[model samples]
Target: MIIFGTALLAVCHLLGIFLGDLLGQALGVKTNVGGVGIAMLLLIFARIYMQRRNMLPKLTELGVEYWGALYIPVVVAMAAQQDMVSALRGGPVALLSAIAAVAVCACVIAVINRTERPQAQTDGAPILHDNPLLTEAE
Candidate 1:
């Protein structure tokens, strides 16, 4: 049933937290590093594995997807509560790091856009790019 999907997610979350704690300890850190991210990855892989093996039922898949959709906003909310003001106040390193990250991401995205070829659909509908700015003016 739908509860089974929730149970699966819970199991993945617990395992992710456990693994994250272990990773943190190994890295000489006191905090759980990437626990939620690990959990999300676990959920995604689990869903894919189950779907490939025909082990997931439609109703349970729906339940898993519903919770997965909810999970993103929940994570965003949790992230919003972080002490960013203090981090920025702590040093210029934080601001610089943020800028570097954005720059690297933009470069990677540009490279991918340049190299990736668009696939032709059997239905012949124009494939929509993720960025609206890249779309043809109709």
Candidate 2:
């Protein structure tokens, strides 16, 4: 089962590489990141759909938890990039602008989530708090 899943994942990755190459050529874009990003986004959506349908197993159950650890290297490399690091060191104005952009995005997301959240019934059951510990106690 593990071998079959590994082969399937490898095939999907190879297909993504070819698809990305074609997209880059057609769009005149040179970065492989765009292709990889598309592939990752597709995978994320697939996982979410499978999970919603209760058809997906936990990563630990599939012995694929270690694969999740591999992302640390990619994150570290991105953080260590000189150009990205230098972008922050440009000036106080640039730094403040970046911070403000992030703050605005966070505020927008919070408002959207608040507005879209499902309302709780006022019957007898206690409402669940966002805290996991509170949920466990209930």
Candidate 3:
């Protein structure tokens, strides 16, 4: 059950790393090119596909979801390890890229927020009602 999901996740992670390395090499960059993110995306898509095909067990899906939830925290921790001072000092290009990324993310969030419909409002007051069984005829 869970073992199958774990195996799938592991394979995706390894493949992502390999692809990232290849991408970095192709781009003449030394850093991994979004390997973890790519891995997470792959795992999510694979799980979705499996679920659609009715091939995924509940236990396996739960396992995948647990690890997927950990992805953000893990990625954040990894990013915290990067030397920001050195990266910033590297060039204006890095700073510009960061600014662009933030801008893009902000725009995407705004769009998503705008696309969502507002929930209907309601009061919590209880309604009063007369008992039908307490009529004069009774």
TM-score of each: 0.74, 0.47, 0.70
The alpha-carbon lDDT assigned to residue 22 of candidate 2 equals 83
Instruction: Give the higher-lDDT candidate: 1 or 3.
Output: 1
lDDT of 2 at 138: 67
Error of 3 at 102 (Å): 2.7
State residue 35's C-alpha deviation in candidate 3, in Å: 1.8
TM-score-best of 1 and 2: 1
Per residue, candidate 2 scores C-alpha lDDT tens digits across 1-138 of 344334434454566677878888788887443454554444455556756987656652252223323434664477458446686778787678768989999999999998996888777867665788876886
Order of all candidates by TM-score, from best down to worst?
A: 1, 3, 2
Model 3, position 20: C-alpha lDDT score: 88
Q: Give the winner by lDDT.
A: 1
Order the candidate numbers by lDDT, best to worst: 1, 3, 2
Cα error of candidate 2 at position 13, Å: 4.7
Better of 2 and 3 by TM-score: 3
lDDT of 1 at 70: 89
lDDT by residue for model 1 over 1-138, one digit each (tens)? 889889988998999999999989999999998888999999999999999999999999998998888887998677756847766786988778878988999999999999999987686667765767666555
